[model samples]
Structure formats: C-alpha cells, structure tokens
Target: MIDWLNSTALTVFGVGTTWAEVLGFVTGLLNVWLLIRQHVLNWPLGILNVLLLMVVFGTAGLYADMGLQVVYVILGLYGWWAWLYGGAGRSELVVRTTTRAEWLGLAVAGVLLTGGLWLFLDRMTGSTVPLADALTTALSLLATYGQTRKLVESWWLWIAGDLIYIPLYGYKDLWLTAILYVAFLTLCVLGLRAWRKAIG
Candidate 1:
C-alpha cells in the first residue's frame, strides 16, 4: 500500500504522490481549518503538518523551508501552551489587532531575518530559490508568532507568504504543496474576516 501510494504519479500535474506528501496535505488542511475556527487543536495539527513537510521539503531541496518546519514545531508547541494559558489570568487567548509598535518591530525583524537567511542559503547551500524561500520563512515565523498571540494581523502576513509560496512550490515541482498554499491563501482571507469579527 505504501509503495503503491508512493509510486503513483498524477498524470495531470505530473507530480508523484507520496505518503509523506499526502499526510502533510491532509494535516495541513486540518491545521488551517482549525485555525480558521480559532480552535486550540490547530497547534497540535500544525506540528504534525510541519513534521511531514520536513521530509517533502528536504527532498525538494528547499533547505530553508525544511529548517522552517523545525522552527514551526517549536512555535507550534509554544502556541499550544499560549492559546490555553497565555491570556489574562491564564485564560484563553483572544483575538486582537497588532499595535503600531508591534507591527514595526515585526517588520524590522522579518527584514533582518530574511536578509540573513538569504545570505546563509546563498553562501552555504545549493538552494534553487533562496530569496523566495528566505522571504517566506521569515514571514511565516512572524505570522506564527502573531497567531500565538491571537493577533488578527497574522492572517495578513500569512496571505503575503502564501502568495509567494504558491509559485515557489510549483517551481520546485511540489504541485500538491503549491495547491495547499492556494487553499492557505483562501483560508487566510477567511481567517482575517473571522478574527476581525471576533475582535469587534
């Protein structure tokens, strides 16, 4: 069964379907769905998704992305705890808008991180899409942090990252992953609206 699934190639997209990719895709979908509903389960599901994708990205030569998954695991754990206890008086976290100062700080951090990763990948690795990979990684880190804080602006950062990720994943021939990002883009829009309503 595993071999059959791993060897099966989708004729339409010419991308081979693997068990890791399938698992990653399924968990990725569930993670975003839970996130849209603001369920605490999203964090645990996200941890599984990232672990599965680590294999996918590692094979596809997306070193930065593979590394990003490691970060996602740590962030996922943090988010799980934060959502349950990082609120006022150890209550559930609530949706909120990012302050101007917070936004400025995050923007600066993202720029510096992107630049640093770009340089590292360019000099130290054989990454095919270093800049795009670095940019998405940096934005995703910020987005995940925002999500942990239950900030509505996290969806905005995710929207931006997904826009870049779709084409980049496609270029790497990870068609299913690219399609997942398209779904992510849609979910980001929905999540933004949902969080806004919650905040108001």
Candidate 2:
C-alpha cells in the first residue's frame, strides 16, 4: 500500500501524479460529505485529508496552501471539540447564522490576512500563485472558523474560496485537488441549503 501510494501513476500537464494524491482526493471527498451531514467524524477524516494534502501542496510549491493544511489540522481539532461541547451546558452545537457585525469583522480580517500572506508568500517563498493562494487561504480560515461555530454562512465562504481554488489547483497541476474542489463547490451549495433548513 505504501509503495503504491508513493509510486507515480499518471502524468498531468507534465506533472507526475502519485497514488498519494488519489488517497487525498478520496479522503477529502469523505471529509466534505461528513461535514454536509453534520457528522463529528468529519474532523478526524479532515485531519487525514489535510495531512495528505500538505505533501501535495508542498511539492507543488504552493507554500500558502501547504501551510493552510497545518492550520486545518488545528482548526479540525477545535471544530471537533466545539461540535461536541461548545454549546449551551456542554451540549452539541446547533446551526446558526452570522450577524451583520460578525460578517463585517470577517470581511476586514479576510482582506488583511490575505494581503499579509500574499506579501509574505510573494516576497519570502517561491510560491507560483501567491495572491490566489493567499486569498483562498484567508477565506478558508474564516470558513473553517465559522464551521466550528456551526454558522450557516460558512458554506457561502467555502463556495467562494472553492471557486478560486479550482483554477488555482488546476494551474498548479494538482488536478485531483482541482477536481475535488469542484465536488466541494457542489457540496457547499447542498450544505448551505441543508444548514439553512436546519436553522429554519
């Protein structure tokens, strides 16, 4: 299994793709599916998915996305705990909507973080798509945080981020990841509808 995962399977846009990317793609699909179902198991599966993707993005020289995987690990753990006990009297968290003030704060923070990360990546790292990666990374942070809070609006942020991620990953030759984001975009739409119904 380990040998197969490390072995090159196909060439995509002059880039050799391995079974590792396939594994990451499968687990990523599972993670998003679980999230849409509001299942707590998504966290552990997400952790595994991100670990695989850390290698994928790192090798692709998408430094910002590589680092985003690390953040996802931390956020996954936090979301796990929050979903289980970060509710009233230690109950499971329920779906909720963000307030206008909260949305404004998130917007400000997203812009600032995207700018900072973009500068850092463009100046310090050998990143090929710094601006796009930084923008998606910043928005993903907000989306993940909102997911932890069980906010219905997080899916919207995810949809926005995934829109950029599809082309970015495709340009980076992470075709599996790009395809995964396409699936993620569809899932985000369904997730938003489901969460909205839950809130209603």
lDDT of model number 1: 0.91
TM-score of 2: 0.94
Q: Clashing residue pairs, candidate 2?
A: none
- The lDDT of each candidate is 0.91, 0.91
- Model 2 spans > 4 angstroms off: 1-6, 11-15
TM-score of every candidate relative to the true structure: 0.95, 0.94
Ten residues in sequence with the least summed lDDT for candidate 1: 3-12
Q: What lDDT score is found at residue 149 in candidate 1?
A: 97
* lDDT (tens digit, per residue) of candidate 2 on 1-200: 55566678777667788777888989999999999999999999999999888877777788888899999999999999999999999999999999999999999999999999999999999887889989999999999999999999999999999999999888877887788999999999999999999997
